[model samples]
Target: MNKDLADIFGNLVNRIVSFAHLAFDGRIPEGGAPGETELRLAHDLEQRIKALHRHHTALEFRAGAATTRAIWDAANAYQQHTAPWTAIKSDPARAAVITRVGLNLVALCATLGWSIVPNLSERVLGAFGCNNAVPRWPTGPLLPLLNSGAGTPVARLGLPVEKISSEKVAHLTARFGA
Candidate 1:
């Protein structure tokens, strides 16, 4: 069950941050600032996760399981519903938008998924330029770390993730439910 959620988040951070790294030609930004459209998408995602977090925090044993699943589901839905990558060649202006959204999405995941996978989330946050800060629950529209003074932006995103094996699937099927 743990691996099930980790795999979803791992794949999401890897793919999205990979795209964000390439979109800027490997140069992130001075203060890890992503573009406007990216920020908007990230803010929207944060809102969804925060909503789920509010609902699950009251439960004891299943406190974060539902929130983790919600984040996973939301990430998958975003990948399926939007093709931000299509803009690279078709519309140069749109490329920035895609990059911002992708990078910020990674940031959002880090903030919201900290409880589920703290170390992995920290890596994703580091890739986005937040080094020492912890993510606050019920996150607001703006990311404090991204806008603050911190780590240098890179041309290539460095997300450290471990892939989940197929054997983990059998263990997870029994646990996933609403």
Candidate 2:
């Protein structure tokens, strides 16, 4: 689970960083430079995500519901902020980044038994394009740290996690209750 979390968090960070470049560096080419409000919102969202990533890394990639909620809130806020921008909404690349981030976040929340509003998830999934994409959950060896319930304290952010191999790949699936 530690390795899995690491991969998820890492990918999210990569996506946010890439989007930040596009939002702040004016690398959107035809999108033109974003206004101050958009830039400020993007910067704030990026910084929050980065801080979460750093804290998670220090905790060895083991985070709880609070961390997951924090991530969702930040990204969701950014999505809402940029929803009014026709340029951003029309751009496939930029829209894809936000959509992918939201999709993965929903998946992560499900895997960790975290709760998210159903309408919000549906709305986010519909952003830009409705490409029936499914979120890929982590599939790898079960880390002993997660199984043992032992973790190194890292500023009360989360527990420590490390990779440990077992017999086969343990696939964790999230089931929704009816």
- Most TM-score-accurate candidate: 1
The TM-score obtained by model 2 is 0.30
How well is each residue in 7-64 modelled by candidate 2, as lDDT tens digits? 4443443343345345534121222333454445445544554555555567734343
TM-score of each: 0.66, 0.30
Which pairs, if any, clash in model 1? 26-154, 26-155, 27-155, 38-100, 38-101
**58-111: candidate 1 lDDT, tens digit per residue:** 654365666666766676566545555676677655555444544555566677
Stretches off by above 4 angstroms in model 2 are 1-29, 60-65, 85-178
Residue 116 of candidate 1: its Cα lDDT? 60
For model 1, the local distance difference test gives 0.59
All models: lDDT?
Answer: 0.59, 0.38
* TM-score of structure candidate 1: 0.66
CA lDDT, candidate 1, residue 10: 70
